[model samples]
Structures are given as structure tokens and as C-alpha cells.
Target: MATPLIEICVEGIDGFLAAQEAGADRVELCASLVEGGLTPSLATVRAAVKAARIPVHVIVRPRGGDFLYSEAEFATMLEDIRILRGEGVAGVVIGCLTPDGLIDEARTKALVQAARPMAVTCHRAFDMTADAGEALEALVRAGVDRVLTSGQRDTALEGLAILKRIADQAAGRITVMGCGALDADSIRTVRDAAGLRELHFAALRTVPSGMAFRNPHVGMGGTGKDREYELTLTDTEAVRATIAAAKS
Candidate 1:
């Protein structure tokens, strides 16, 4: 069987390059993976686009925490989108919701319009919506090209049922990209259950920090601690496994 295409999420320039080299179909570029993924800087966005052989989709989140955006944050998001579009990005990944956790159709539609000529992906904010079914319809109506969801659960494995439902409801009007905690072991089950064509994961592992010095003053437990950055590097083995499973 042929391998299914994989879209990997990258945190920085190195990760973007690695994903392309490791056979990713595309990359979602963002900054501060620890914060879940806030919008990347203009320089980083441009660099990723220039460095990547494949398409690069920049995340347009102003800040992390919630999908709800303040007036200033919303304005920032729009500005970021314009900047990235000008930089020749393939698409933009963003999501906005009302305070009540419902898709903000008006705001989302406006963003979609501003992102002309480039695809728009409604991010995991769909998982936070009050009604996944209603939100799916709203996103489709808003002209969103795709949605990144974990089935409204914390991870794809846990949310397979809901993810499958959303995929069925989407009915080809839009794509339902399964994401979150997707690895070689579970990729096959997710693909089988969701019946989705696209899947997302960070083929990255945490590496130990080389720094030996300990900041005792900053310790919550008053003891020296070890910390590591969540860096993105394509794990060829993991990617190969996921692709194989999808094809099966």
C-alpha cells in the first residue's frame, strides 16, 4: 500500500527544514511550542517559507491559553495574517471562538476573507466549542479549508469517536485533520476510526538540557531541576510507521 501523506507541526526553522527533509507533505510553523503554539515572528515565518521545499502554513494565534481574542489581539492576528500572506505562505492556521466556546462565525469569516489566495485552517479551537457538530457546520460555512481537532478530547486516541463523527458530518465539505498525541503506535487506529485522509503530529522527542548549572533560587521545590526545550525534528521511523499504518 502507498504511504499516506503526513503534515508535521514545527516550532522553528530547524524543525521546518527537518520536516521537509523527512518527507512531510507540509508543515505548520509556529513559535513557543511550550505555550501550545503562539503566532511566530515575521522573520521566522519568512525564513521557514524560504527554507522549506514543501508548503509552510503559519499559525496566526496572537497568544496561547484560549481561542477567545481581545480587540487588540484580533487586530494583531489580522496583521500577522497579512504579513505572512505577503511572505508567500501556503496558508494560515487560526481559530477564534466566542466567550461561550462557540465558533465566532463573523470574526472567522472576516479572517477567511482576508486570507484570500491562501488556505485557512481552523485550529483546535474546534475542540473547545460548545457543540462540535454546530462548530463544524459553522467552519464549513465560513469557507475554512480545514480543521485541526483531537475529537474534542485531550488526545486523538481518546477522542476517536467524536473525531469520526465530525469527519462524517463534514461530508467532504471540509477536511478534518486528526491531531494530538498521534504516534506510530496509535496512528493506524485513528486513521481507521476517523477515516481521515490527513493526520498531524510532532515527530519530536524531548532531549535533555546540556546545561549543568542549577538555579536553586528559581526552584519550586528548592532543588536544582532539569528542563528541556520541545524541539521539532523529523523522526523518519515514526513518520514511516504512521504513513504505513494509514495506507493499511
Candidate 2:
């Protein structure tokens, strides 16, 4: 079998370098992984582009939680793409949807047009669309080079069947990438069952906070069970393991 394209989702300079060193075909640079990824700072994008031999694709999300964007938020995303393109990134990841849970074709087309020369991967927001079939068609028409999805489910394993269908339907018109809760088993499943050549995952592992003193009463972000103290970063070991498993 041909080697699969492993795209590692990373948040900073360290993660980017780790992914390249570990043999990732590309790196999807984002921030706020807890919120399902937001746009990283321009500094991070610049550094990642300079430091990596593999391709670096920046996420164009203004915020997390929803794929729908306000006019201003959409504008910000376009500008971010422009800057990344100038910075010599391999591509940009983007998604835009309407209020009715369909691909916002016009807006998406504009974004893709503005992002000329830089490949665009419609992000997991494809899963949130009302109809996966319709959404896939719209993305194709909008000139998206790839679509990253969990097959319209929370994780790729659960949605392997739909993922397979998408790959067959796309027929190489656009790349279908299986992602979400990915690991060796899930990646192997996509290769065999879904027949996709691209895989995406974070490979995140947590380490204890650097803080010597703790204030149990105060939370820096989130709340209750959703607080941050540990640092969740991508591990190079996990990346190497994933590539080995995919090839196996």
C-alpha cells in the first residue's frame, strides 16, 4: 500500500518541530486545542514555516465551538489566510457554514479564491453540516483540495462506513481525511476500510504543570472538571508510533 499522509495537529513551535522530526507529512497549526482548535498567532505560523521541512497548514478559525462565522470573523479569517500565504505556508485549513447547517458555498468559495496557491482543507466543520452528501458536493464545487472529517461522527472509528462512502464518492476529486480520537487502531481501520490515504490526529499527552505553587481555588481557563493545570502537548513517540502503525 502507498504510505498514508500523516497530518499532525499542533499548537506551537515545539509541536511543529516534533511532528516533522517524527515523519509527519504535514502539520496543521492551531491554538486552543481544548476548544477544538482556534487560529494560532502569526508568530507561531512564521516560526513553524521556517523551522519545518514538511508542509505547514495554518488553521483559519477565529474562535472555536462553531463553524459559523460573523462577517467580521470571516474577514479576520481571510486576512489570516493572506498573511499565511505570504509567509510561505504549504496551505490553510478552513470551513464556513450557514445558519441552516449547510456549507456556506459563497463564503467558502471566496475564502478558497483568496487562498489561491495555498491548498485549503475544509476542517471537521464538514461533520457538523446537515447533510454530509450535500456538504461534500458543495466543498468540491468550492475548490477545496481536501476535507478533514470524522465521517460525520465524533470520531473516525465510529464513522468508518460513511468515511468509506465519502472516499468512493470523491474518487480523488478531493481528499477525504479521517480524524478525531485517532490512534493506531483507528488509523489502520481508515486505511483498510475507509480507503483513505490521509490521516489526522493530535497525539496529545499531558505533563504536569511547571508551577511550583498551586492555587486550587482559582482556575486559569475553563471550569469545574474542565480546568487546565497539566500541559497537553504532542509527543514525538506517539507520532512515530502512528506512522509505523499506518504502514503496518
Candidate 3:
């Protein structure tokens, strides 16, 4: 069997470059992993496209939360896609679903058409569909190059059975890339268990804030209104270890 490509989910330029240096085959560029990875700015996208030695696939998610998009939001997503396409990104990762949890075929196809000549991956929004098998067929019809999913489960491990069925059903029509809450062991487990050819994960670590003066009064994030200053960055060592472990 061929070694699977390790596509890292990177939030910033550092993570982008770190993943490449740490043996990532490609990167899914986005921002604010806290919000489940929103679209990065044009500057970030441009820098990544220029700096990355491996393929830079931009995530075209306008916002986080749900896969459903408003008309205006959808328009904004298209503009972003237009910009990224012009910037020479290797591909665009996007997905549009109707309120019923079904693939918004018309809209999705339009975006895929607009992103022509560049790979278009229908993102994990595929995991939210009414039916995985039915959704797979819709993605194939929409002409997406691949579908990133964890078998509609929180993690790939939890979805191995469904993932295997998806891979088997794909039948080479479109690539089924496994993603979601994957660590080194889970990465290899999903790949081997589901027979996936590509895998995605984020090698993130918490780095303590450098500010000596701590402000406890205000909170930057979290539900308790506590201003936690620790920042999460992609650990190159972690990436290297995960890659090595996956291969091992």
C-alpha cells in the first residue's frame, strides 16, 4: 500500500510552514481553530501560497458553527474563492448544505465550477448530511475532488465503520479524506482501518503567554469569562512525531 499523504490543518503562517517542515504533504489553511476554522485573510492566504513548498488548500468557510450559509454569506464565500483562485492556491475546500442537512447541489456545483482547474474539496460539512452514502453521490455529482469527513462522528476512530463503507462506496469516483480529532495513533488507525489514502489533523500545542502582567478582570475567550492568555501553535516536533508514527 502507498503511504498516505499527511495534510495538516494550520491556522497561521507559522503552523503552515511548520507543517511543511515537519513532513506534511499538504496544508488546509484557515484561521481561528476555536471557531472550527474560518477563512483566513487574503494576506495570510497569499503568504501561505508563496511560502508553502507543498500544496496549499485554502478553506473557504466564511464562518463557523453550521454548514448552512445565507445568500450573502454564500456570496462572500464566492468572492473569497475568487481571490484565492487568482492567488494560485492549489485548491479550495468548501461545502454548502441546505437546511435539511442535504448537499446544496446547485450552490455547491456553482462554487466548484468557479474554482475550476483547482481542486475543490467538499469539507467536513459532508459529515452533517442526511445520509453519508447519499451525500457522497451528491458530492460526486457536484464535481468535488474530495470529501473530508470522520464518518459523521466526533473523531475518526468513532467513525471507522462508516468511513470504511464510504471509502468502499466511493469506488474511486472521489477521494474520501479522513479528518477530525485525530492524533498520531488515530491517524494511523483511521488510515489502516478505513483504508483511507489521505489524512488530515492539526498538531497544535498550548504555548504560555509571555506577558508578565496578567489581567484577570477581563476574559478573551472561554465560557467562564476568564481571560486566558495561552496561545496554541502547531508544534513542529509534534507534527514530525505524528508523521513518523503514522508511517511506523
RMSD of each: 2.8, 1.3, 1.5
Instruction: Please provide, for model 3 over 1-248, each residue's C-alpha lDDT reduced to its tens digit, 9 standing for 90 to 100.
Output: 68888899999888898888899999999899878789998899889888878999999998889988899999998898888889989999998999999999999999998898899998889999989999999999999999999999999988999999999999999999998788876788888889988888998998777788886677765554332666779989888988887777
lDDT of 2: 0.89
What ranges in model 1 sit over 4 Å off? 1-3, 212-225, 228-236
- lDDT, candidates in the order shown: 0.84, 0.89, 0.89
List the candidate 3 regions with Cα displacement exceeding 4 Å: 220-228
Q: Which RMSD does model 1 reach against the true structure?
A: 2.8
Report the Cα lDDT for residue 28, model 3: 94
**TM-scores of the candidates in the order shown:** 0.90, 0.96, 0.95
Which tens-of-lDDT digit does each residue in 38-60 have in candidate 2? 89998998888889789899999
lDDT of 2 at 86: 92
Runs in model 2 with CA error above 4 Å? none
Q: Best candidate, TM-score-wise?
A: 2
Ranked by TM-score, the better of candidates 1 and 2 is 2
**For each candidate, how many residue pairs have backbone atoms clashing (under 3 Å)?**
0, 0, 1
Model 2 error, position 217 (Å): 4.1
Report the candidate with higher lDDT, 1 versus 3.
3
Q: How close is candidate 2 to the true structure, as a TM-score?
A: 0.96
